[model samples]
Structures are given as structure tokens and as C-alpha cells.
Target: MDEHQGTAMKKKSSHASAITMNKDLEHWVSSEEQADISKVIQERLKDKKPKGKCDICRVHPAKSICIKCGNSVCSSCYFTMVGLCQNCLSKDTIEKWKNKKTDWKKILEVDWVD
Candidate 1:
């Protein structure tokens, strides 16, 4: 009935509303519809291709695209650790041939040509 009591009631109502909202979010995220939506998103992303030639060499067809700079690069020009093209990686690294230091030839079973 007092001003203090009204403020306390408002706080309690806000807390209750927050709890209800969290429950709704949990239900929405865990539902079958959410799974279907995720699947659809992944499928759409898989079909998407990068635009233009390789940003690094600008010669080869871009097979891998950088998620950060959105630069399209060929497999030979792409650096997996930094997720960037050869030119971008060179700028970030202290050494230009830092990628060559790693024994990728021995590690990977597949043959990768430059």
C-alpha cells in the first residue's frame, strides 16, 4: 500500500517476466523447428560461392575464401591456421615464409601443389 511496497512489487514482477522470457527462449532454441532452421541455414551456406579470382595470386580459381576479409583464394594460396589468403597472412606474420616452417607435407596425407 506504501510507495516502497509498490516498488518491491514492480521489481518482483520484472524478475518474474525475465524468468518467463528465459523459459520461452530455452523452448524456442530446443524445438524441432529450430533444428530445421539450422539445417536449412547450413545447406544454404554450403551452396554459396565466393565472388571473383584468388585475392593472393589473382591467377588461380579461388577454392577457399577467407571468412574475415571475404577474400577468395585458391587452396595453394590459403593459410588454414590464420584462415586467410597468402598475402594477408604475410602481413600478419613476422616472417614471410612462416607457413613453410610447418611440416604440412609430412602431416597431411594429401598432396598439395603450389
Candidate 2:
């Protein structure tokens, strides 16, 4: 076969294998079971929110997580602009990060990916 035909054959086989994998997955997990599992995952995620007082203040409920240290902090203790808790925000830290914009959600949620 020519190179183009070989590529086409590869794609067709890959597509067929993907369909077979999907069929196997369907046999292993019914739609109802998937829904039930989704509900359980949601429940687990709901409970994953920072559940106690601030790591810094020990008073207010944590409203944010530190990007550098992963400490749960209250709004008062966390600087939204810097995306850091009070403990992590020194003069040196401010100087180092002065001109940067911090993506708090992206930085903090990276820990959850593992």
C-alpha cells in the first residue's frame, strides 16, 4: 500500500478499537450504575471543601487556599490580588511577585488532579 493508504488503515483500525473499548466499558458499567457512581463522586467532592477554621487565623472559615503553601485561609487572611495567605506573604514575596497576575483557581486546583 501507498503511505496514504497505510495511514487510512491505521485510522480505521484505531477507530474500530475505540468502538470495541466503548462496548467493553458499556458491558462493565450500565448507565444507571454510572449515574449512581457520579452521585457518589459528587458527594465526595462536596465534602472536600475546606471544612474547618482558617489555617492562619484559626477563627473565620477558610474562603481561599494558598497557591504556594496549600493552606486554607479566610478572606481576611488571604490577599486575593496576590493569591497568597498571610503566612506566605512576606516583603520578599511581595517584591518577587509584584508585577505578576496570579490564577488562584488554576494554581490551587492543581493538587486535586493527582
Candidate 3:
């Protein structure tokens, strides 16, 4: 056969193979009764403490405090130091404080709430 005809046949074979693979996957899941298995898996995977208190808010466990501004922040908020709710602090300043190379007494003092 010509190169063009060979390519067309190869393409058709690939498409048929893909359809067959998908059908096999669907049948495998159906035979195992995936929905019930998944439900049991989910129940087993359920966390003991499914929902915990907010880390930032004093109403909950405080995760970490910002170096520039002494505001309590959660694990998510700790990485970024910029945003509306963000307490923006330069990374350099935090490093200096951490190393005890600078006196950040003023910044370190927590005064987030009355």
C-alpha cells in the first residue's frame, strides 16, 4: 500500500484501540461496583478532626505571626506577604529577625486585637 493509505490505516487502528481501552476501563469499574467501594474508601479516609478552627483568627489556633506586622496568619497566608487580608512583610526583614541580626522588638510585639 502507499504511505498515505498506510498512515490512514494506522490512525484508524489507534482510534479503535482507544475506544476499546475506554470500554475495558468502564467495564472494570462497573464490575467492581466502584460507587460502593469509593463510598467505603471515603468513610475510611475521613479525618478524625474533619474541620479545625481558623489559624489566623484568635477565635482559632494561631499558626504563625507576620514578621513585619504582628498579625496571626494561617499556614496558607504565611507564604504570601501581599493581599487585602495579607499582612505584607519583606522576606529580608523576616530573615534578619530570625537570625537575631536585627532588633525587631517593635514589629515582634503582637497587637492584632484589643
Candidate 4:
């Protein structure tokens, strides 16, 4: 077969693109309505508090905060030695320092900038 026959060129049409806005999902919001929504959301966020439940177990009341990620956790889900939540540290690392204490405050002191 000839090269031109093997590799055919696809001609782009002048028609509109396939992407189109769905009218059913679109909504027209006025400036006044938008401002009211923004104000209400801000007020609700200001009054909202932590759920007070363990992020890991979601059953027990959170008694401590993980120093690494600031996630609220119960005694069972928190690694007190490393000052990190079960979600932050690996299982192997948790077992390695099961009995040892870590200076997690040093993490806060470290300069992150390159």
C-alpha cells in the first residue's frame, strides 16, 4: 500500500465542539443571592467545631490530637510515643518505636524552605 493510503489525514470540521453545557444542570444566580449564600456559609463555618470523635475509629471520643496532622484521635488510635495518628505513621514504624518516645516538637522547629 502507498504511504498516503496507509496514513490517512483526518479533516477537522467547522461544526461546534462536542462539549456543551447541560441546561438542566445550569442555574442563574443573582449577585444578591450569591452574597447571602456566602454570608451564611461563613457564619456556619465560624460556629462549627470538631466532631470530637476519633478520625480513625469514629466510635470513641477523641482524647488527644495528633502532632503530625492535627487529627483528633482516641488513645487506641494514637501513637503516643511518636506523637502521630495511626493514619500518619506506617505500621512497621509504629511497632519499631512502640516503647520509645520521640521529640515531635522538633518537627515543628525544622525549616521547610529549601
Candidate 5:
């Protein structure tokens, strides 16, 4: 009857509705239907192949692809450490060194100014 009691009843109803909705969803699909859907998905995935030419050699068929950049690369150009094609991984390394060089230059400039 009071505002507090009304709010509590609304909260209880919402919670009960959520549980009922979840229960309804649990039986929405039969086990056979689920199995069929999963089988179809697996078959489709199995047919999928990595796309693009080798990023490094640019000639060989790419056997592996980088998960991050999705760059197709041959086994020879694939770097396992970073899970990237050699070209991408080397660019990352070079960028890091460039940043470090700029940082060192800035530090030296500050020291000289002082």
C-alpha cells in the first residue's frame, strides 16, 4: 500500500518475470534441433579458408594468417611470438624503437636546457 511496499512488489515481479523468461528460453529449442544447427555451423566453418596472398614473400600461398591483422602469410613469414606476419611484427618493433629514440631525445634536450 505504501510507496516502499509498492517498489518491493515491482522488484519481486521483475525478478520472477526474468526467471520465467529464462526458463521459457531453455526449452525453446529441442536437443535434435540444437545438434542440427551445430552440425551445420561446423560444416560451414570447415569449408572456410584463410583469404589473401602471403604478406612477406607475396608469391606463395598463405598457409597461416595473423589473427590480429588478418594478414595472410606463408609459414616462413609467420612469427609465432606475436602471432603476426613478419612484416607487421617487424613494423611494430620498428615503431617501438622509434618511440624510444624520441623519448631519449626529449630527455637529453631537457637535461641540456637545465
Candidate 6:
């Protein structure tokens, strides 16, 4: 019986008691408890909302999202390839232009673009 032994014994007893308590309370959890848990989770998630416009068009109010680019482009800004918005332009196409730089062009297919 040294200090280390005493500490280890105490820790073992504490763990055993914790296990006993958990077993005793295992049945205490019910559907209502799960609902309360979900409610709390929902409240936490409700607080997280994106606060910005589409990174592409920068015109229409951003309502859609693009996880690939980590942007909240507006629905009109989310365009497709060959019809992609200027912001959505892929790096490969950008490099293809070589030294000849151009202004951001809205993908022609987007509704907002002319």
C-alpha cells in the first residue's frame, strides 16, 4: 500500500460506482428524453445560417449553396459547365486562356445572365 496503489484503488472504485449508476439509470431514458435531446440539437443547428451572397453572380440574393466551392451563390448564379457563372469557372479553363485575361463572365445558361 503506497500512494500510487491507493490512488489506483480509488480510481477503480470510482469507475465501478459509475458503472453501477449507469446500469441503474439505464431504464430512465425514454422517448420523451430522446425528443428533448433532438429539440436541443435542432435549436443548436437553427443558429447556424450562412450570411452572404452567391460568390459567382453576386447579383441575385444568395438562396442556393455550393459545397464544392464553399460558396452560397444565389440560385441564378449556380450555373453549369459551358454555362457556368464567372465565379464557377474551373481553374483548367482559366489557364487555357493563357495571359489573355477576361472579366468575370456570367455563365450564359444562368437565368440572370443576358
Q: Best candidate per TM-score, number?
A: 4
Worst 10 residues of 2 by lDDT: 42-51
Show where candidate 3 strays beyond 4 Å.
22-28, 31-36, 39-48, 53-114
Better of 4 and 6 by lDDT: 4
TM-score of each: 0.38, 0.37, 0.29, 0.39, 0.33, 0.27
Residue-level lDDT tens digits of model 4 in 1-114: 776754543122212222234443366778999799768655654544335889899999987776656677898898776666888998887787676676656768865554
The residue ranges of model 6 lying beyond 4 angstroms of the native Cα positions read 1-15, 22-28, 50-114
For candidate 2, what is the lDDT?
0.78
Model 3, 101: alpha-carbon shift in Å? 63
Q: Write out the backbone clash pairs for model 4.
A: none
Per-residue lDDT value at 83 in model 6:
30
Q: lDDT score of model 4?
A: 0.69
For candidate 2, the clash count comes to 0
Model 1, poorest ten-residue lDDT window?
Answer: 90-99
Using alpha carbons, what is the TM-score of model 3?
Answer: 0.29
Angstrom error of the Cα, residue 10, model 1: value is 46
Q: After superposition, how far is residue 11 of candidate 1 from its true place, in Å?
A: 45
Q: Order of candidates by lDDT, top first?
A: 2, 1, 5, 4, 6, 3
* CA error at residue 46 for candidate 5, angstroms: 9.7
lDDT of 6 at 17: 100
> Which is better, 3 or 6, measured by lDDT?
6
Query: In model 1, how large is the Cα lDDT of residue 89?
Result: 61
Q: Which has the greatest lDDT?
A: 2
Query: CA shift at 40, candidate 4, in angstroms?
Result: 32
Q: Candidate 6 on 40-101: residue-level lDDT in tens? A: 65565454444476666566676644434446666566544333344667767655754565
Model 2, position 21, has a per-residue lDDT of 93
Using TM-score as the measure, name the better of candidate 3 and candidate 4.
4
Off by over 4 Å in 2: 1-48, 91-114
